[model samples]
Target: MDNIYIYMLIALAFLAVADLVVGVSNDAVNFLNSAIGSKAISFKTIMIVASLGVALGALSSSGMMEVARKGIFNPGEFMFDEIMIIFTAVMITDILLLDFFNTLGLPTSTTVSIVFELLGASVCIAILKISADDSQSLLHLGEYINNSKALEIILGILLSVVIAFSIGAIIQFFARLLLSFNFQNKPSWYGAIFSGIAVSSILYFILVKGVKNATFMPDTLKDLVSSSPFQVIGVSFLLFTVISYLIIKFTKNNIYTIIIIIGTFALAVAFAGNDLVNFIGVPIAAFNSYEAWSASGVLPSNYAMVALNQPVGTKPILLLIAGLIMVLTLWFSSKAKAVVKTSVDLSRQDNVKERFEPNFLSRSIVRLSMTASEKFNSLLTPGSKRFIDKQFAKPVQALKTKSEDMPAFDLVRAAVNLMVASILISLATSMKLPLSTTYVTFMVAMGTSLADRAWGSESAVYRVAGVLNVIGGWFFTALSAFVAAAIMAIVLYYGRVYALTGLLILAIVLLIKNYLSHKKQSREQKEADSLERSESSSTQGVIIESAKNISNVVKRGNKIYSSAINGLATQDLKALKKNKKNITKLSNEIDDLRDNIFYFIKNLEEPSLAASNFYINILSFLQDMAQSLDYISSVSYKHIHNNHKKLKFTQIKELQEIDAVMETLFGDIKSAFASNSFTEIGTILAEKKSIINLVTEKIQKQVERTRSEESSPKNTTLYFSMLLETKDLLNATMNLLEEYHSAHDEKVAPARLPGSADPSLEEE
Candidate 1:
């Protein structure tokens, strides 16, 4: 029994390492997004700079580990056994929750997760203790828990979102107006002033947020800061501003580059300084509790954890090791890039396609914003409106090198993003208020994107949706963190040994699964792009490219459909999930092909723009086929995942038959497209119709069975939906075959040739 506490202390130390890796992966987006987005520095250089900041920040951290000790609950009220259980549960929950968010590439507040987790796990135990003791009433829960402190943290996090967004928007708008998009031609003074302000903010951030918590800071200096905060900040600002102005005059340098590098370092420092508690705080707290118990020379359940309420110093060496782990994760973790990409895609200035689909809420918000803009413009005088519009206009051409590799925003905005975010967060830190760095930095970047008009009409809805999705995830983090911690705490309390073993095993499994999944996805992405670009310089080339794409669709579609059927019949969700992933990659490829229509058209000969039109039609059908397969495979996986009733045996047999017919039809379609002959188009079309009829019959039988024999609504829906989606999938394949046949036979009259002659005007 005594050995359990020792085992738990060991577990806490181990979980801390895992937590640091996952926590840094999620939080990397906050500091790295701006640097990565701007491409101001080389990838290696940016990483090295950020890594150093994390290491330094970790060393300087105030060791907010006290928060885990007693910030959420009254640690003095609990025995060593209970405190160990609660702390252990927190370590498990924090690592799992952070890792889950990282795997999904969403940036959530580690502050929120850890705080709510402590609150939750503590609250659960408090309830149990009250229930077991007649003297302790539910009304006296506050004596055991620190609900007030937890509420304050929650409210502070919520407040920072609105504040960060508003401040970011206003400052960014003026910054852009002062230094327009094409500010390179502007006077040097304009750039200097921008650099001055940016550098000043970051300087303030470092002093206020980054260093105040340094474990090595002398007591006298801490007292001096406490005594005259304003005087200290003023001196720092003056020095940074002077340096900024001197750099402007002394060198023909890119001052924006200087600002970005400095700002990146500051934010990284702030992250490690302030956010370290979210990772190793609980483990350190548990270690402290263990030490206290050992010194007491009492039984585990007899000793109280009263010392937890007092602040304890964290070992600088331990901080250094945690910092090293974070730095390594930054340099090596593949998921860091994924998280960074999500931020960049949302805030990028180019016309690249959006990753998130727009919903009604996003569309409505965009529409309302457009309406307000129109009304505001109407109120302005013509001259004033024209002046404002010009400031916001995108330049006719941007400076160029590798546009593909260029940052989402320029150095100016990147510097502003890093500087302003650091200032805001540092101020909060100085005031002893809890400001979520992730929430602040992410919102500030978004706010600046809005001001720069990166969220134009073409992408506003998607950008808004992306922002909303991330914000929603933050709230989910709080909820999930709390509930999961509470549950784990209860399990640890009653089923101590078995629960610990089960949870540790579960955490290891999930981490391995996500790691392998992420790696496989990376490989798949490379393979998808490595396939030859379907170039179309001439009508012949166009036909050949179309055949290749068509062949791919046919081949992939058959496999996807077959995989869904077999997996469903066997209840193998893993196979079904893999198939769903394949379908998604295929759909993304078609979307890329569609997005390239302009370039494909530009490459065509004057008389061969007709090839563009043909290529467009071919891609359209292929996209539809891909989508149908996506729906089928995804729904099948969901049904099986929910443990829904399996389809009747007869229904499975029917699906097997339909899968065979679809396979044959896909083969025929592939041969016709490969030969560009479509001599077998009639045969393929006939086979498609036959397969559709076969599925329709199955669907009808299911309907009848539902009315008389079948009772499960989910089972009915699952079977019917697959059959219907399969029908659509078949029709799409046949349509592409017909489209190819038409493209192959058309011959426009040369006497009055246009770039694109309609098929109706072509000679027979």
Candidate 2:
């Protein structure tokens, strides 16, 4: 009996280690993005700075551990067994939730997850307590929980997004007005002052929010630092300002780089100081509970854990270990890169393509903002407008550098982002609000991007939509954490070790599966990229490069068409579903290619704009091929997924004939594209006619069967659909082959492809 509870505590210690790894993987983007996005310093240097911050932060974060113990609920209200179960539920839910978000490559609020999980698990156990104690009525439940603190946490979740975004925008609006896009050429003193203000703010934030919790700090120093805050600010500003000026005056050092490096360190330290509690606090509390239980000589269930309400301190050694895990994760986790990419993609200054598409809401918002801005411009005096325009004008060097580099924004904006977010998060920390570091950091970047014109008109809709999607994910995180924790708490309360064994195993399996899936996806993307031919410079390169793209499309298109037909014939839902996913991926790749036409044109040397026209036409034709496959695959998967009756034997037989013809078409087209020869295209074109005729015959037979022999409406409709789509697919396939043949005829043909859009490719 003693060993059973002891083992649970041991399992929790292991979970604390795992949580630190996953938690850091997800949260690394919070601090690393601004530094990396600005390219102010090398990535290795940024990690080193952030790693040092984490180590120092962990050592200073002794006081924050109480949040995990008594911040969400009153520990004195629950038995040792019930309290341990809640801790177990919260840790498990948090690791899974945070890991899952990292897998999606989206940043979510870990603070929100931990808080809600605690709230949820507490609520669940509280309900059980009420139900079990017949004499204690529902009205007495208030004594079991700290409702006010929980409300503050929930409010903090909502507040972080709005406040972070607004403050970032306001600060950046003024910062850009002062520095402009050409701030690099400004006088050293101007840069120094900006650096001073930023450094001072971060200094105050770090000291007030991060180190205020330090148990080892001398009392006199702590008092002076806390009480004389304005003096500290003045000294910091003077100190960093002189230091910044001296560096600029004496060396080739960029003040922005200094700010970015310092900012990264401060944010990382703040994260460890604050959010580390979310990871290790529970395990520490559980261990403390186990200690008390051991000394009491009471059975685990009978021992009440009143010690949790006391101010227990976290051991410095444990903090060092957690920080070490975080440092290692920052150094090696690939998922951290994925999450950082999302942050950079949303805030990039260029009009590059986005991963998330613009939806209707995004379009509407963009449209309204544009209209309002135009109206506002009209209201400005002529002189004011002219001056404002000059202030906003980007320098030529900055524009040229943007074309060459992948930095999402300039270092000034990066500095502003780091300064504002670190300030806000630290303020929240000192105020005892569990502000979401992820929310504050991510939205702050978005807000600064908006003010700095990174969300230019060309990509604003998509960028806005991406930000909204991430924000929506934050709200979903809270709901999911609550529900999952509640349900898990119930399972542990009743199911005990049996449930713990199963869930722990389930968690391991899920983490492994996500790891493998991410690995496979990364490998496939690299392989696809390696096969891509360089962009067309001359007519010959256009021909050669276009051939590679067309051949790849043909290979994928053939599989899609084959899977759709066979999946329907054999009712293989998995095959059809896999094809559906492949088709979507192919479609996105083509769409991205299509969007890159602008950059491709920009890169082309003078007198090669005609190549742009030819390139565009080739892309259009290939896109049609992909869409043709996508529609077929999607419809096939849906029909089977809905449990629609499989096509009759005769219908399958006719479809197989069409499938065979289409397979030949794919083969010949692939060969033509691969070899950049159309000698076989004429044969392929002739076969298209016979294939269409066969599809006509198949449809006519389906119609005849529909009138008399067909028993299932689903069967008849599906059969006729596949046959007609195959005919349209044949037309698109033949037309694309013909256009490439035209490309062969005239090495530099006109911009327009000869093929018409295949009407059948349109979604039904």
Candidate 3:
């Protein structure tokens, strides 16, 4: 029995390390998003600063471990064995929940997960204790739980979301008004003041509020900070203001960049100090419980976990090891980058590819906002409104910059994001609230973007949808964490060692599966022969770029057409389902290409205005082909999915023959486009009549079969639908070839008509 406890301890040690890796992956975005979004400094520099903050913050995190030990539940109420079960359950649930969110690239609160997991597991154990005792009843459950602290932590975290967003928005609106979009041309003193306030706020919260809880802080300094925080604030503000002014006056360096660098470090420190407990606190508490049990010389079931109720200091070495793991994860984890990208994309100042789609709620919100804006503007004087418009007007340079070089937002917004998020998170840490870093940072970024008008009419709906999706996921995290941890506690309580072995195996399998799935998805995105947009400015450049897209479309469209025929003939439902997905993806790629037509035209050289016509025609033909294929795939899949009868043998054979001929034509078209041999397109055009006739013949045969030998009305309908769509599909493919062939002819023809051989037709 004692040996099993030792094994549990070993398992927990590993879980703690694993939890740190996953927790950091989700939380890295909290500190890194602002600097990365603004492009304030080199990424290497940001990481170095953040890494240092994490190292120091981990050392200070010793005080936070109390939350996991006794903050969520009354630990003295549980025997050592029961306490172990609760701890084990919480660790398993926390790691899995955080990893799941990370894999989805959505930032969720690690603080919320850890707190709820502890609450759930302990509550489960408490219920068992009450049920087994004759005197103890349902009313006695509160004695086993720290309901007051649990409620406070939950309420604090929820309240922080609203507070962070409001403060961020108000500060940003004023900051933008003060600096305007042309802040770079403003007087040096203007920037110095902004930088001074931003940097000073970060320092005060991180040093006074955050560091006052550090294990290594001297008593005198903590006392000084606690007793005279206002004095510290005033002095720091004055000192940083002078320093900022000197830097601006003496050098060409941007002061906002300096603030972002310092702010990143401050937030990183606060994250580690507040969130480290979410990762390792449970395991450390478990270790302490085991020590107490062993030394008592009593059976584990009989020994109470009284030691957990008192304060216990965490070993510095353990904190250091956990910090090292987090720093490394911050530097290397691809998931961390993905989570950061989500926040940055949502808050970007200009449009890029939106990762989410608009929903009804988002649409309604945008409409209401527009209505309110109109009403608000009616209340403003004309002069005031004009002044506000001028202040918010973005510079022309912001519009012309290349996408890869453009920052997500200006440095001012980034500074505000960092300053607000760091202050809020550090303040929570000071009060021992364990407020969610993810929640505070993410909402602050969103709020700043909203205030800066980054979410313009073109992007407002999609951005709102993305925000709502993420918020929905957070609520899911809380409920799922509570339920899962409770269930795990029950299993561990009764099944003991066998249950532990099964769960460990299950966790290993799930982690491996998620990693491989993410890797495969990344590889597919890179290697897929998807359609691409034309970025060419000249006619010749457009021809080359657009030809590549045409070739890819032809190649993919061929496979999808063929798959539909084959899957239908065999009634292979799985293959048909996959074929539907393939066709839809191809169709969406074409749509994306069409969406870039505005930019394509804008980028065209004056001499290449004709190229726009050719490009648009090519896209239209490609869309036609995709629409045909999409219809075919959809109807085919629907037929098989409904368990409708397969087509008759003759009908199947005729469709297969059409598929073969269509495949040959598509192969020829693909080859012509791929090699830039527009001459071959002429040959493909010649066979267009034959291919269309073949599809017509299939339609005719299906009609005859339907009229005479068709026994099932459903089969007749499906066969006729496939035949007709195949005919449309052939026409679209042939039209694309014809269009390409004609464009080639126009390219190679003499600049003047053949009649220009006459001297009068020639230019003087």
Measured by TM-score, how close is model 3 to the native structure? 0.93
Using lDDT as the measure, name the better of candidate 2 and candidate 3.
3
Off by over 4 Å in 2: 212-221, 355-379, 395-405, 431-433, 529-538, 638-724, 741-764
Residue 66 Cα positional deviation in candidate 2, in Å, after optimal superposition: 0.6
lDDT of 2 by residue, 287-363 (tens): 98888888998877788778887887777788888888989999989888899989998998776658788999999
Model 1, span 560-599: residue lDDT tens: 8999999999999899888888888788878877876765
The TM-score of predicted model 1 comes to 0.81
Which candidate wins on lDDT?
Answer: 3
Q: Which of the two, 1 or 2, has more lDDT?
A: 1
Tell me the spans in candidate 3 whose CA falls farther than 4 Å from its real position: 215-220, 400-405, 431-434, 607-609, 744-764
**Cα lDDT for residue 166, candidate 2:** 89
**Root mean square deviation (Cα) for candidate 1:** 7.0
Better candidate number, 1 or 2, judged by TM-score? 2
Candidate with best TM-score? 3
* lDDT value, residue 471 of candidate 1: 94
Model 3 per-residue lDDT tens digits across residues 1-764: 89889989999999999999999999999999999999999999999999999988888885437778888888788899999999999999988999899899999999888888988899999999999999999999899888898778768767877898889888999998999989888888899888878887898878764566786789988887777767877887888888888998898899999999889988888888868888988888888889888989998888888898878878888888999999999999888888899999999998877889999999999999899989999999999999888889998756543444569999999999988887776666656674777898899999999999999998999999999999889889888999999999999999999999999999889988888887876676666586777877766666667778888988988999899999989999999899988887787778877777776777777876678888998899889999999999999999999988778787788888888888887787787677666656665677877777777777777677667777898888788788888778778777777776676576655343321232321212
What TM-score fits each model? 0.81, 0.88, 0.93
